[model samples]
Target chain A: MPRYALLVEYDGAPFVGWQRQASGLSVQQVLEDAGASLNGGVPAPTMASGRTDAGVHAEGQVVQIDIALGLSPERLRDALNFHGRPHPVSVVKAAHAPAGWSARFSCTGRGYRYRILNRRARPALQAGRVWHVQGPLDAEVMHRAAQHLLGRHDFSAFRAAACQAKDALRTLDRLDVERQDDEILVRTEARSFLHHQVRNMVGTLVQVGLGRRPVEWPRQLLDGRDRTLAGQNAPAEGLTFLFARYPEGLDWR
Target chain B: MPRYALLVEYDGAPFVGWQRQASGLSVQQVLEDAGASLNGGVPAPTMASGRTDAGVHAEGQVVQIDIALGLSPERLRDALNFHGRPHPVSVVKAAHAPAGWSARFSCTGRGYRYRILNRRARPALQAGRVWHVQGPLDAEVMHRAAQHLLGRHDFSAFRAAACQAKDALRTLDRLDVERQDDEILVRTEARSFLHHQVRNMVGTLVQVGLGRRPVEWPRQLLDGRDRTLAGQNAPAEGLTFLFARYPEGLDWR
Candidate 1:
């Protein structure tokens, strides 16, 4: 069996999430079914670098799968995209990873972006893709507050109650906030994140942007390490999984 | 009767076009219905800065409507937006122009933008909002070619066969091409345009971008002044009516 890495992009509005669920459709099930049919009905399970919740989009999600039937990278990508039809999911790229390199285990870093439509008027173009904040948001203040979230810490304050991470400890490499015209973009990079962590952090920063909290609130929350003292999770629609980075020898493409 | 001016924005995927037609629904019909309902069942005819074809978006379209019942600018916008619920259309701003000024006649300049998804993968995020071009497009070449289209010309080569413009002569103020990441944006500004002029120009520029046509091809087409001498019209989905400028002291806000 040969293992391949796929860079997947999707609009999350139609999906239940990245994982297969008994309730509704998922990106994983669609790809696996496409692969199974393409491989003559042999079961093909895909392991993603991470899973995004319902209504969470992805620009560059990584997935690794071992197929019994070998196909060229271009043919495999085209076949999967062809079968995925009308569904908003797309396999943007496919490359052979090093043998035994798993998308999840071999990932070195992951990046996410959250888009905020900070304007009085509602979004006509990016209606469901952005979090529409009617009130003016101070992006500079939000950026100043977000800087305190950098480095390793026990991010229990920003962790979801249902998070399955064994420990609250994680290293956050970067958290940047910028105002692009009417959009407030928040970008974050880290080795890993607890469930709903990115959305939680953004939600907390939104408070600071609104002048409801001081600039040092996020830092204080990090120091407190108490989940009950944090802000609500930002809606999943605004979040996008940007990319997952792998080690040097993994043949990432 | 008091008239009001509206700065409109919309995703044009839903309606037939900006004008009412017996063939299908249009943005004008919906806006009229919404306005009629909002104004005690009285018909409110809206005169827009210009009409867009089906699937053509608008970011700053101007429209003027007269109603028997008087309403402040604030109430007018809120009421129109309220009645236009569930539709992608939005009245982003409302103001009162000079008493005799019309949305169409008062316009001094108009701007349009065309977006091309220049990538191998089809657009997952901007589906139906962009023209997906799988082949590589050289933005610099496109820009070089577009320079020839600026300043003034008889744009018959880029006009639609069914265009009703009195003359093909028009002055183009600006034509710009820029690449932003995987997207190619073409912006054009002019006093007015012939039917399908923007889309036709973009399609011709696309040929130049792909190296199928010379950089001076557009200038040659202008010299020929023949409709059949140019490339096909680009899809309406990619073009957006960006803005319509009016004269001073009319309360544009």
Candidate 2:
């Protein structure tokens, strides 16, 4: 058996999430089925770096899979992409991985991007791809407010109730809010995130941007250490799993 | 009647192009209905700078509409966007035009952008928004070939049989092809274009990029003036109406 690392991209609107679930179709099932088609009809399981919520897209999701057949990386990618046809999922790249490597445990950092269409009109081409927020929003204020969550902290305010993580302490590497034309983009990177942490932070920052809350709002929520005292979770459609960074010298493009 | 100029944007996947036809829903009809919603029961008519083909999107399409009510430009824009809900069309901006100004006649230049996803894997997020070319495409050679089609020429080789223009002679101001990662962007600007001109040129450029045709192929096509000898018309979904440039002084922001 050969282990391979795959870089996947997908429009999450069609899948339940990145993981396999009993409820409905998932990105994992689609990839596994594609792998099985090439592996003598034998099941091939896959593991991803993280699990995204439904309707949350991914630009560069890393996954690991084991296959019975030894195929070239390019061939494997092409075959998987062909089998994944009619579905909005693509295998961007494939490479042979070291025997002991893992997609989940070896990942060093993860990045996410959230888009808000901050204009009076609803979106057209970007309808399902962005959060359409009407009225004025000050990105500078949001950026100022986002800095409060930068360093190591107990992020219970931004954690979801359903989050199963044992500890609430994590170091936030970056959180940037910027406006381009009629859009407000929220980008964040960290070693890991609690369930819905990025969405909750964005939702809270939006309140600060709209002048509904002061710039110190996020700091207050962090100090309170209460999820109920924080802002609402931003819609899932606005979020995108940007990328997962691995340590240097991985030898995979 | 107060004549207004509207800056419109839309996802053309669901509509029958920008004109109102007998077959299906159109962007024009959607705008007219949105306009009529605010103008009592009277039907509002509109004229556009250009008529886009089916599945052709728009970023800054300019249209002229006559409304009976005396409302501020922002108010009119908000109202139209409100009524256009559930549809993919949006009025980005609205402003009062000069008494005799026309969106079509007053336009001095038109621009279009064509996107090609040149990769082995099919598109995931940009499915309908780009032309996915599975294999290699030399964008540098394509850019070299595109230059041969610039300047004034008889473009019968690129014009559709159904083109209503009386003459096939037109000035092509710009045609630049460049690649950013796996995507090839073909951008063009001209005083006007014949039916299917931009798409045909892109299709021909792809042929040149794929090594199927020489870099001077477009020059030969230009000289021969034979549409049947040229490459196919690139799909409409890959084309976007970028903008319509007007004369120096215009109050519409």
Candidate 3:
């Protein structure tokens, strides 16, 4: 069987998330269905770098699948896209992966972005693509506060109560907050994350943005490791999986 | 009565267009209703720089209204936005306009953008915001064709047969076409336009993009005055009225 790394893009609004479930549609189901259509009777289980939650969009999600088809990379890409028509999911790039290459374990970093629209009125076209926050946010103060939680820490405070990660401590490579016009964007990079970690941090940082919390509140929450100490979970709709990284020589095309 | 100029933004998915009609919802109707709520009476009639068609969005639509309210510019913006809550309309900015100022007459230029997703899959979240073109297009050729149609010309070939503009000749300040990833964007600027002119030009340019017509087809179409020579009208969903320009120091805020 030939292994291929697929660069994917999807609007996650109608999906139940990246993983398949009995209740609703999932990106995994869509890909596997297309895979089944492409390679008869061969169950092509797709694995991704991260299993994003429902309503989380992705412009550069990475996934890997094994198939017995002898089609070239270009033909496989065109065929998969042809079979996946009418679905919002798109395989933007397809290439043969080196043996033992996996999208999940081979990645060096994952980047996520959270969008916030700070305005008096609700969103129009950007309704579901951003978190609408009405009130003046002190971006400088929020940026200052976000820096305190940059390094390795026990992020239990920022992790969801239902998180299944056995370890709460992880290193955050970067967490930068910036504002553009009436919108604020938060960019975060890490090797892995506990469930709801990014959303929880955004929820807490928004409090700092609103002047409800001091600049050091984020560090305090991280030190305390208490989930109840954090602010409300930010809505899932505003988070986007930006990209997944791999080794330098790996072919992504 | 005090006259005010409003900077408006809206998602045009729900409205029939900018003009109020007997059949469907319109941006004019929504703004009037909001004004009526604030004015404690039937709202004063509203006027806009351009009356966009159904499913056409706007980011910097300009409108003017005369009312007796003694509200300041900031208060007027807040009040209108408050009244327009949950509606896809927003009053982004507002200011007192000279009594002689009219949204339609005082505008110097109008800008519009058409977004097309040139990929195999149907868009999910961006379903209504972009045209899904499931075939390859030569964007460079499209750009060349668009450049030829720039500057002043008789645009009768690109105007709809039902266009109400008595004079089909108009000055086109700019027409730019660019491609990013799987998306192609066409941006145009002019002082005014005939009905369906942008859509018609885009349709014809798409033919050039797909190699059905030569790169000079657009210029040829412009030289000819027959509307039947142009391509089909592109869908309205992908069109957006980007902005309207006024003379410097006009102080519309």
Candidate 4:
């Protein structure tokens, strides 16, 4: 069987996230179903770098699949996109990966971006693509506070109640907050994270941005290891899985 | 009557341009109806700086209206936004303007942006928000060619068949083309424009960008002063009305 890596992009508004479930449609199911059709109706399993929650978008998600089809990289991408019609899910690029490379295991880093539309009135031009934060928010404060969250730490306070990760310890690589006009973006990267960590951290930092909480709040919450200390969960719509960074030797087209 | 200047933002997908039409809804009609509801069923006449075509978006459109209702700037902006719901229109801000200031007549300049998604695959994140052009585009060539259309010139070659302007002569203040990643953005500014002028000019430049036409083609098209010499009129979805600049003394909130 030939293995191919797909660089995926999707608007997660209508999806149940990256993994397939009995309840609703997922990005994995859409790609696998399309892959099945392309492979003479044979079911082909697809694996993603990470599982995203419902209504979470992705700009550069990496997915690996094994199939018996004799299709080229470009043709397979086009076929999947054609069969995935009307679903907001799209395969941006496809490439052949080495025989033993797995999308998740080979990935050294994962990046995500959280967008907030900060203004007095609700967002109009960027309606679904951003989180609408009413009133003023100081991005500099949020950026300063976010630096405390870098490095190795136990993120049990930020983990979701339903998280299944066996360990809550993870190393965060990058966390930066920047503002442009009425939009504030929080970009983050890590080797891995427990479920709901990004949103919980962002929600907590937003409180700092609003001046309701001081800059020292995030570190205190981290030390306390209490979930109740965090702020809102931040909505799922504002989050996007940016890219999965692989090791240098592997080529990802 | 209280006169207010409004900074408006809207998604043009569901509108029949900014003017009221017999067959469908318009941004102007929605604002007038919302104003009427707040003014005890009395119609409020509203004027806009520029009338956008259907499916053309706006980030910072300007409008002026006279209403009999006694309301502050904040309240009026909130009321309009609240009543305009279930629609993709929003009044970003409202402010008290000079008694005789007209949104259309008192404007010093207008800016517009045209976006093109330059890639082999169709856009999933920006589906209806951009013009999807497959293959490569030389934005540098397009920028150089666009310079020929700037300054005061007879724009008959770019004007629409149904354009009602008395003369084809207009001064183009700015025109620039730039590319970022797989997107090409064309920004333009002038005191005003003839109907479909911007889109037509963009379509011709796209030809130059695709290497189908030479960089000097725009200059020849301009000298010909014939509409038939230009390329296809670019689609309405790619265009956005950015802003309308007024005189320095009038405060536009």
Candidate 5:
């Protein structure tokens, strides 16, 4: 059997996130159906790098699957896309994965982006894709505050109470906050993250942006490992899985 | 009566377009209802710079309305936005217009943007917001070809058969084409446009991009002035009304 790595993208609004469910559609179920259709009734199981929550989008989600049928990578990509037509999911790229390569363990880093429309008016087409906030925000102050939470640390303050991670310590490689016109985008990269980690960090940053918390609030939250010390979890809709890193020889492209 | 100018933005996906219709929702209908709600009972009639077709979006649509209410400019803007909630339309900016200011007559130039995703797979979240074209496109060739259609010319070849414009000649101020990754964006500016002019030009340029037509196709179409000589009108969904310009002293903001 040959394994292939796929770069997947989805709108997450229609489906119930990436994991398959019995009641609603999922990215996994859609991809499996596409693969089955292309393989003439043979279904394949697909594994993704991250299992995103409902209404959370993915621009460069990585997935891997094995198939016994023989198909060129280009043809397979086209067929999967064709079968997935009319659905808000797409396989943007596909390639043969190196032997024993996996979308999960082979990844070195994962990048995520959260978009916020910092303006008085609500969003239009970007309604569900971004968090609409009224009033002015001091991005410079927020950027300074975000730095205090970067690097290796116990992020329990930003972890959800329901998070099942056995360990709360994680290394955040990078955290950047920038403003583009009326929109503020937060970019982060980490080897791994606990459940609701990103959203919790954003919630704390939002408080700083709104002047409810001081500039050192993030550092203080990190120093305090209790989840009760953090702000509310930001909505999942504003979060997007941007891309995942893989070993050099993994053939991600 | 005091007249005010409104800078509006909207997502055209859910509506039948900018113009009001009895069959389905429209940006006009939504704004009108908001205006009625703000005015306590009187409905305010709004006039826009252009009446875009179905599925066409606008980021900087200019509209003007006359009202006898006591609300300040800022208050009027806030009130409209508050009432406009739950709708995809928004008044991004608002100001008191000059005594005789008009949205349609005071414009100097209008800018339009068309987004094309030239890639192997369809877009996920941006499905309806872009024109998905499979395979590679030569942006340099398309840009060179687009230059031939610039300047003042009779664009009857690019006009739709049902277009109501009496004169087919118009002056194009600027036309630029650029590619970012797998996406191609075309920006065009003109004082006024004939119906379907931008879409038709884009269709012809797409042919040039795909190598289906010669570099001189756009020029030939412009000189021919025969509607049958040009390519089909591109879909309305990919077109956006970027902004409208006015004389420096006459600009509201």
Candidate 6:
């Protein structure tokens, strides 16, 4: 079997997250079905760098697929796109993966962007693509508070109760917030994250931005290590998986 | 009756344009219905700065309405938005309009923006919001070619046959083309325009960007004054009514 690394993008409103399940359609099922069209009805097995939750979008999700069909990178992308028509999913690029390269383990970093339409009126142009907040939020305050969680720490307060990761300790590489017009953007990167860590942090930072919590609240939440002490998880629609950063010398095209 | 000016924004995907017609829902009908909800049962009449075609969006469309209610500007905006729930239309701001003020005859200019997604893969996040062009485009060349359409001229070549304007002569204030990443933006402003003028000009400029038309083709098309000689009209989904410029003294809030 030949292994290929595919760069995928999708509007996650119609999906049941990135994994395949028995109940509903998922991004994984769409790609596997598209792959089976080229591989004589046999579904191609795939593994993604991260399993995003439902209603979470992606601009540069990395997925590795093993299939029997041999084709050029461009043809593989075009074929999958052709079979995946009418679905809001696209294969932006595809490349041959090394014999031992794994999409989940070979990636060193991951980036995400969370969007909030901070306005009194409901979203019109950006409906479903952003989280709408009615009250005014101070982006500078949120940015200052976000810096407290940048270094390594035990993020048990931010992790989900159903998180399967045995370790609560993870090093966060970046966490930045900025406001543009009526939208506030929260950008972050990390090696790996426990379930709902990024969204939990965003919810807590929003509290600081709204003046309900102080700048040191994030640090206090870290020290408390109590999930009940943290703010609720932000909605999934605002989060987008930006990219998976791999080691140098890997061909992404 | 109290007259008010409203700065409105809408997705435009679900409505049959900004004007009221015998069939289908229009943005005008939605506003009138919302007004009637506040009024004693009679619908409030409204007029817009421009009558956009079906599927054309707006960021800052201006409208004037006359209603029996004497609510304050802030309360009026909140009331209309509350009644307009579940629809993608929103009134961002509202202010008192003078007795003689008219939205259609507003004493200034109008601006529009057309977005093009220049990429090989089909759009996922921006499916209905942009015009997708698979071929490569040279933005610099397109920008250079767009300058030919500036200034005053008889724009018959870019006008639709059904355009009811008595004269083809008009002054074009601005026409600019720029590319940001994989998207190309065409921005234009004028006191007024013939029907389908912006879309026709965008289509012709795209030809030049794709290397199918010469740089001087726009000049030749303008000089010819034949509508059939110009490129096809671009799709309505890619066009957005950006703003309606009023005199400096009028309070838009």
User: How many steric overlaps are in each model, in order?
Assistant: 0, 0, 0, 0, 0, 0
Question: In model 2, how well does chain A match by TM-score?
Answer: 0.97
Candidate with maximal DockQ: 2
Candidate 6 lDDT for residue A94? 92
Ranking by TM-score: 6, 4, 2, 5, 1, 3
Q: What is the DockQ of each candidate?
A: 0.61, 0.82, 0.47, 0.72, 0.76, 0.78
Better of 3 and 5 by TM-score: 5
Residues A36-108 of candidate 1 have per-residue lDDT tens digits of 8666697578999988999999999999877777888877888888877878888888988776788998899
TM-score of each: 0.94, 0.97, 0.91, 0.97, 0.96, 0.98
Lowest lDDT block of 10, candidate 4 chain A: A244-253
Q: What shift in Å separates residue A40 of candidate 6 from its native position after superposition? A: 1.9
The interface RMSD value for candidate 5 stands at: 1.2
Ranking by DockQ: 2, 6, 5, 4, 1, 3
Q: What's the best-to-worst order under lDDT?
A: 2, 6, 4, 1, 3, 5
User: Can you write out model 3's per-residue Cα lDDT over A191-250, one digit (the tens) per residue?
Assistant: 999999999999999999999989999999899999998988999889999999887545
- lDDT for B184 in candidate 3 is 96
lDDT by residue (B115-232, candidate 5, tens digit) is 9998888898788899888868899999999988789998899998899988998999888899998789999999999988999999889998999999998998788788997877
Regions of candidate 1 where Cα sits further than 4 Å from its true position: A249-253, B249-253
DockQ-based CAPRI category assigned to the predicted complex of candidate 2: high
Answer with 2 or 4, whichever has the higher lDDT. Answer: 2
Q: Which pairs, if any, clash in model 4?
A: none
Task: Tell me the interface RMSD of model 2, in angstroms.
Answer: 0.8
Error of 5 at A157 (Å): 0.9
Better of 1 and 3 by TM-score: 1
Residue A49, candidate 2: Cα error in Å is: 0.8
Model 5 chain A poorest 10 in a row by lDDT = A244-253
lDDT accuracy of residue B41 in candidate 1: 98
Docking class of 4: medium
Output the lDDT of residue A149, model 2: 86
